[model samples]
Target: MRFPPPNPLTLGALALSMAFPLHAQSDPSTAATLAPVVVHARGADEAPKDLPYSVDVVDGITLQERRLLNVEQVLRATPGVNVNSSGGANVSTIYIRGVGALYPMSMDDSSVALNVDGSPLSTRQIAIGTLDTDQIEILKGPQGTLFGGMGEAGAINLTTRRPTREWEGYARAEVGQDRQFLTEAAVGGPLTDKLAGRFAIRSAGSDHWIENDRTGGPLSKPRDLAFRGSLLWDLTSRTSALVSAERHRLRHYGEQLVLMPYSKPASVDMDPGLFQDSRKTIERYTLQLDHRFDGSRLTATSAYTDTYNIAPVVYDGKLQSALGRGSREFWNVDEAKERVFTQDLRLSSLPQSDVFWAAGVSYSTSRRSYDTPRNTYGDASAKFRDFDTDRYGVYGEMTYPLTRRLKLTTGLRQSWDRKTYNARYHGGGMVQTDSRKLDDSFTTGRIGLSYALTQQATLYATYARGYNPGGFNDYAAQPDDSKPYKAAKTDSFEVGFKTDSADGQYGLNGAVYLNRVRNNHLLSYDSATYVVSALNADTESRGAELQAVWRPGDGLAFTAGVSFIDAQIKTAVHGIGDGDVQAGNRVPDVSRWNGTLGVTYRKPLPAFLGLSAPVLHARVDYQYVGKRAADPQNHFDLDSYHKLDARLGIANGRAEYYVWGSNLLDEQYDLYGYFAPPSVAYGAPARGRTLGVGVSYTF
Candidate 1:
């Protein structure tokens, strides 16, 4: 199944050929223009063009067109964003502007805040079903004033489609390589004079593509099911209420971690019995209420989520072979459960006013429990831990017009957090228990000024401060490793501009930023001793991003985005290395340069048979990711790589069909790399070329 690496010259020729339209047709009287997208990540609804920071939006239409199955795919084409996943549906890490946690712990929260329908996500290992998406908003920068401590880097906000009064529905089916099949259906309409309801469901299953050399069969097969339902009711002329419920379940045979020095096509030379089975289930419910006055609006939201995951896995990949044993024996059965509850209340003035203001208060609580049973060389042991966290915050922001074309904005937030942990270990005729508590209170804010250079252009500058709270490491087997780490803080400054052409055919956004971070919480793993710890250090990061979209006549559109970042450690800490050895090292998992280019074209066809007018569409996409360091000392580096995708489709008002190919060039790359037990290098390779066909019908 291995394919030769693509030649640069051949790829260039192919890209050029695909960029041109296949069939030239007369231009329609009405030319489409890029629409202004509104975002709610800033604690208020506002147009992205009016914001002072770097923000990007991906609509549901684009998601359908791209056939994106996960958040990582959606973020790869976005500017100033990077995603690293370890060959699982939910195990993903996101980095923005070189600010991210390279190695995340079970208890340590992420640097970026992830939200679905205004409810914050507590765990990064939970699946994000994209069955009925409305839009995804990416806000890049320090957002501590509104989003709390996890917004040190930025935030990702996902909104799902709501019930509409009009009757509408769609059904889609897809078939792909490696025995993959997917089906999705949605229906919505008015249930009564003042009530509307919607329901959506998605189911998918795929056989493993990677093969195990020892067993001569596929390594892992995965299956998933998800369901969502929503209801909207108008209680009165000025008041309304909405409620949503969702459930998702996933089961997979196992995860395949390829050994270092492996050849292309990703084959594992290990015992099939060493693999594990995994299952995950998640459920969520949310309620929203709104009331309007003459000049202002009141809003309230409440949400609850519960998640459970279990896996039986082998800890050492090469244990049987390295120990000269004939069978696999060392293993661990792990289980994790989490429950979260959140509520938020806010009031804001109408957006049309000269002076805009919003204030909100939020309260959230989360509980997590973990259990693991290990069997190594006939020795048995078990470990259990529980964590509870509570957070409360009050935040407010205001924007005042300084003159006709100038405005000043400021925001402030005060937050308090408390966390408690309990651990129990039972092994070797001994039982031990430990308990600890940690708490912190802090203040964060943002200030900015914006000026309109012209009717179509705006320039802005901002300064913000953000922090990630400290937490105790649950994986620590020793007393010294159980201590809580200090909180990490960042002071950031950014300057940016948003502009549109007078003819409304081109748009551009760009930003330059500098960030200084202190007491930066870092995760370190000792493969030899199987111990994990957290430390503190100082780091500095500087970056710039540019994005542009162009639309000419004749049904043509093009988009290009690029980003450059330089992030390095300014001070060395314990467990990394000597002071000078680690001080100047490049930050792990941060790429120096990344970019994406896209081209799309469409042409209408003459009406035929009873069918209405149809359109032929073609698209090409390209992405480039630069080299990245895998460790603190920068000894191991992942080489730069590029990927290309293309799609050809035909569509009308009610039905559509498309053929799509991802990684058309068959480029080989690593998603991420880490040290396995016994200092073995292990990584997950990116998927190879995949070709699929899909059809959808709407009624």
Candidate 2:
């Protein structure tokens, strides 16, 4: 299907109308007040209104109320963000500001960086399980000076709940359609006068929503379990120590793909040999220490992470017969492991001072290995590869008040990266071996100016530079793939404003940005050899975002967000296989227009059924995602769609019960599309309407 291009004039008008200039508004009615939210995505903690860049924060309470199970769900409601999955629970791609990798192949690294408790996760794997969290912060635009190579596009930071002096705990259970079930619990308290401990656990799973017609069996099912523990100790009057650990296990059964353009919304027809079975395990450990002096503080953090994954399946579908293969089946097995260790140290002046300054140094090393074995009619072949990477960086930032109402900020970082690749192949009674080494060094920087127009309003402008280091391709079957690619870089400029009413009854924030990228890394798949590789191109993106929150009266609140992006390639390139990509094409997986609207009401209810102090809560939310191109050629696509979710409940302070529904309209949409062997195309389908009820208790 084809649609008309979006009109820029109409979009500009809409943005101006929705996000008028910051100005004071008068209202006679008194309303409840809202507190300012603080975020720490930068090196130091500060209120979002004071930052020169766009940032979004979601608290743990909102996550629970929405019953969000993964990071993808959290990002769907955020402005200027998009998520695409390969029809699996453990594989996904996230896009911010039209910058992201689009495929599930293990070789491509994500443009956006994700961190938990200051420890970065490998972008090659799925970032799941959002349990026992304090808050999630999303920083838009480049974070090069503070984060180094990984923050080419942006960054996401997750903070976990810490141990407390007083004992407290909570538990929740829920059951829903498709045999969905979930149970989670958390507890925290003091172990001794100076020692505190916290623990959390979660077990969740769901039956297959898609069924196979060939064998009358389920096409996909997911199960997951996770545990986290932490301990905090006051070493002395001026120093403290903290230790944390986490483990997660996930399993999936059956294939994650469906026959596109032919299969029904929730069904598939495939050969029994194509069934997929996979398992993934991840573990992480971290230790942190902090010392405070009269005017400054010193902090250090050390972290280690390990991940393992395995999958065995038939690569060829029923198309084997159609391609005149004579019932020959292709069996393949994949096993992979990754280990990373990182250390960071920083010193900063107290934020309360008129002049604030912070400096940090970081170092990280990672090792990864993978083995793939294939069996084609008793002809066995295997490929084995290993990768090693080491990175080091030093960064510093300073913010000084030039005047009572104006400030200037500047930061810079220098990074060095080195990578080594070793590969071996054995097949057809022959053996081959290869080795390569590559290294690069680069510098990134940021500059910003902020002005307080009024006591409650701030206006700012910023410029930043970021980059992603080059590396060897995992699937190096050809000479071109063996050579390392050049690093990708971006230059961005932004201007924004934030304002709030004196009574805190209304708030508004918006930004406009322009970004130019050079040597942008992209992933391409070869249908003939089933190999995925990397390529580079040039692109440009410009966009605007607006968000508003209002509390017109007691027990009533409304929130809305809107984004408009125009991203396109500036140069042509030769893709994998025999495909030529032309210039002037929109980047894949980026929507032109996205928005969200939400309403919430809470009120105290009269006592009933011998219950005392009961309160009722109701919420409704709607999201719109515009049509997007699936490939560089703009030949295949995903249509525009909308989703609605609602929740209603009653609760006291310690206990609550609620009923919730998602995709209430039962809309059917495609999450992603890909081309496979035998010239066939397939699409991963999104979920339909789902209804459930849950209960929770606090002690």
Candidate 3:
């Protein structure tokens, strides 16, 4: 299951041999070009290149041809974005503009708003689909005025392919290293007059490939299955409705972080009976309604979702096995359940005049509770917490032309939040029960100005303010120690420019931003008692990003993105600490430098088979992540690493076949590193190289 590491030269040659189409030719008229990207965040279908804001759109063609299946892969090559994970697909959080906490807390509100088809998703939820995707939009800066409470920092919106009046479908299958298998299919068509239906399903899994030295068996077998169905009804020429239902389930050995000085050959020194496994289930249903009038549109969206997850990690295992009776009796466990309901109603004026506006009201309610996370250590060694949040907001935005080439834009949100908490903790011979309530109301907004410099270029500047309400830590057994941490208020200033060639052959987008956060959420590890407490401090982050896409001719496309960021805490915090954090510390998981490069080519192949010449498709992607602080305390640093992914295949309009490789060099890096209960540093290593072959057929 392991491949020997390759040198840089070998890596290059391997990528080129498979990804370079030397004996292929393309019809000059059919070469794909860099077209204007349309995004929906502006309250309407507006081309991002024409707008003043910063939006990165990954289109469906790229997603399909590049073989980017999951959320991580889809965002890996994006500028100014990072997904810090704990080795498990579900155990991760995303950081945008260097403004997200890597640690996972079921009670903490996410800094990034993850939306799928207008439905909000929690931090641990699977926010992307493996099939039937339309596009993904990554919007920078605060989006509170439009995306609601969780949009304090940024937003990621994933839209799924809709039901079509014309019959269409695709089925794909892939087999990969480690005995991995994937198969997905989607079908959409008109079921009846005025009615259309779509259904999609995906099933994927991989055998545990990490050899266990103790037993010579693999460490984890990971897999997942997801299903989605939707119905669209054209009630009238001016009104329509869409209803969708989805369910997903996952299983795997999660968070397999070994001791320091990681070894090679894809092996782990996990002890026998490690009790390492993770499981998750998600069910969601949504309804969307739209009506159009002479000059405006009205829309309504509602969703109900329930998710449950359980994961056991041996981050603190060495201490337990040496002192406790067995390893399974003492590892750390995380189990939680959440249910959410959301509704959004909005009206927007059509782009029929120089003046355009939108107004909307939103309401959402969420309830979450955690089950005792300590394994079978003891009956009384348990922790329990319950959190319920009810939030409502009203927002409005307007854009008007101040001059022939100048425009002004502004928006605001009036928000009210109510949260209730209940907790009970019994561990280390201590027992505590506490209940608290939080009620707050706040206002957030943004204002900006943009001017058209030419027919193909626009310049813009903007300021935005966003906030995250205070929260509590159930593990703080004492009342004062459990006091709510201060709310995180953020102010962001940004300038950006977007331009594309008049011929539509290339485009460039760039932005610079500064973000100041008051009462930034931080964590303090009290090593004296081996406990963690939530605290607050101040932080400042400034960064620049550039993204470019170029298509010269002859079926060649190139994409490159780079970002530089300096995000750190500028001051010391309050409350408990044993060097858990300090002044002038780099924000954990915020890499100082990161970038991605991609190349794709397509051309008609020579007549080899006894059929029409098929098109040869090839793609290569490279990514880099600069070293970063692994934990708040700066306990360790994750070294910089390089990764390469490539795919080569042939397509004959309706069917395709390909071979792909991920991390072809077997590059190794820690996904995350954290301290165990007793101060030992442990890390979860990223997955090793994966090679696979796939096929897809369309009808």
Candidate 4:
């Protein structure tokens, strides 16, 4: 189905900006002619533009222009962002500003907080693995009052397109090198004048790009599918509700690069035909009711999520008999299930000249289970494990105008959490029922002040407290002796300035922040016994970020940003000491310097050129990632690299075609972390240069 052309409201506005005020010079005899320019438009709840904070918004066009498949690739150009991968198509570890989940081995667990469509989605292996999104917003710094719990450092909010009143649909298909083929589509329209709905689906599968020279065979085949739908009902002029649901599944026969940078790295490559098998599925359902009265708003949100993961992990060296006397194949098979339910209610008072406020209450409960059914070749057998956690929180924030130029904002959150863990097995083949419970409550607060220094500039400073709740270990532990972990906390202080000139052609924002973390969590493996576990250690991180955008002329735009980090362990508590990680030691995978630039030009050709000819459009972009460490030991470092990606295409409004290239330089770099027999560095080598073409049509 095709819909009418978009309304001219937005186009007319842009046209006016272009034609009438092309320049500031006219009637050169006495005076200059300058047209009226619109200044910054702040949101109802938006803080002062000059608040001492750094926030980045990546919109829909930018996401598609870059052709990034997932957040992992999209965030590569984001300053202070870091990633660690195990292998191709495997688990990816994410960190922002030197803070992220300790370590994630499977689909049900992750440390970073993920918020989707206004609902909080906890960090999970699968959550980050698959996302067909609309726009991504990354807020840097401590966001304790609003997001709570996992928002220790900040929050990653992903906004998906909602239903529209006009009937519209688009579909795209892509094929490229490495046998990569994918299809994605979305359809939406008004079911009735007062209601609208949308449906979307995406599926993709790819053959392993890397070849196992020893076996002369491909290592894996990757497959994925996702379906989603949402509906909006306008009950009244001031009241409406939305419901959304999504299901995703992934199956693959893949490889894990267990050895890296070894003198004989090739010797560790297992036969390509002997790859591991992994599968995961996730389903999410959410409902929200929003009501507005007298410019004040109320919202209630509820969500349920279920995730299942299974993997038959292969170990080539572990299978090889120490004496070279056996030819048996060995592997570890593991499976886990997780279910989560959450509900929250929020009441926000629109910002007024005198006062603005927001208050909310939230409740969440989760149950997780891990099981290993069997083991082969003298490997330890798996046992059943289960954990349950419940959380309740109440939070409120108030902003008051102390003077015409000065404003103060204060917020507080009180939370309580209870966790129960049941471990069924430990070392020495001993089975024991070990159960433990923990109950703790704490309050977090934030204070911020902003001053409008001038019409185009503002200054702000803030101090906040952030916290992350601790829980029972995910993997092996003797049940009887286990104890619930304590909540980790951090104090953050920051100051900054932001400005947008009257011409509206230039904008600059920058901030500096210092953070001190108490009981920092670290995930590491035991050399003697290969179990990965989380440990609490003391640490601190400080950083600065600066961003500027300049659109000197129509069809010409430029953006540049820089980030510097100085993170370290403040005290020696765990076996790893302060000396082990010295001050000024760059955080792993976090580049001290990151930058990006892009140029785009689009215009219509002369009518003389064929009348049927499509419009000509072109774009080019550049990104740079500086050198950084890859391991906690801070031993080996990943070399800094620069990559260029370019795309040229033509579109008639309804149908479009484009050709693109990624990693144009074919730069080789590590993307993830892993443990090898002799190598401590853990990271997956990224892909080389590849070419592809895409076509899409809207009806």
TM-score of each: 0.91, 0.91, 0.91, 0.85
CA lDDT of each candidate? 0.76, 0.75, 0.76, 0.64
TM-score of 3: 0.91
How many pairs in model 1 have backbone atoms within 3 A of each other, for residues 3 or more apart or on separate chains, i.e. clashes? 0
Candidate 1 has an lDDT of 0.76
Please give the lDDT score at residue 118 for candidate 4.
65
Q: What is the C-alpha lDDT profile of model 2 across 1-699, one tens digit per residue?
A: 111133243233334323432222212122123456778776566878777788988888778877777676787778898777655444567778877653323443566778888888865444467889888888898888778888877888888899999998777776677666677888999999999999998877776666666667556557778999999999998899999999988787422555565444466545544434577888999999989999898989899999887765443354344434544445556667889999999999876667878899999999988767554544346878888999999999887889999999888999999999888777668767878998889998789999999988999999999787788776565434556766889898999999988877889999999888898876676656666677888888899999999998857889899999898988888755635567898887789999999888877777676446667778899999999887665666778889999999876556666888889987777777665544565666777788877777666
Tens digits of per-residue lDDT for model 3, 1-699: 533233243333234333433334334347455545678886677778545568888887778766677767676567677776666545666778888753433345577887888888876663345467889888888898887657778888888889999998877777777777767778999999999999998877776755566677667667778889999999999999999999888877466666555656455555545534577888889999999989899999999999887777553344345333345323557677889999999999875456778899999998888665565465567777888889999999888899988989899999998988888777668878888988888888789998889978889999998887777663454555566766788999999998888887888889999998887776566644557677777778999999998888888988899999999887776465556467888888888899999998888776666435578888999888899888766777888889998999887655667899988878887777766444556566766889987777666
Q: Which window of 10 residues has the lowest lDDT sum in candidate 1?
A: 1-10
Candidate 4 per-residue lDDT over residues 1-699, each given as its tens digit: 111132243233223323332222222111111222211111133533633356677765667667766666666767866666655333566666766544443332333556776666655442343234666767676777776766777767677778889998766666666566666777899999899999988776666645454555445667778889999999999889999999877776443554455321223345444444577787889998989878678988899988787766555542343314254445555667889899989888754435777889999998888766555644355667788878899998877778988879788999898877787763476666777777778777689998888878888899988887777766654552245455678888888888877776677888888888787665555543445555555666778888887766644567677787766655433343211444444456666677777776555443232233344556788878877776555656778888888877665444556777777887766565443334333334666676766666655
Residue-level lDDT of model 1, residues 374-417, one tens digit each, is 54533245778888999999999888889988989899999999
TM-score of 2: 0.91
Off by over 4 Å in 3: 1-31, 102-107, 126-128, 266-277, 316-329, 351-353, 427-431, 474-481, 527-530, 574-580, 675-679
After superposition, candidate 1 runs with Cα above 4 Å error: 1-33, 123-126, 253-255, 269-276, 312-330, 375-379, 576-581, 607-612, 676-679
Candidate closer to the true structure by lDDT (higher is better), 3 or 4: 3
Deviation of model 1 at 103, angstroms:
2.2
TM-score (C-alpha, index-matched) for candidate 4 = 0.85
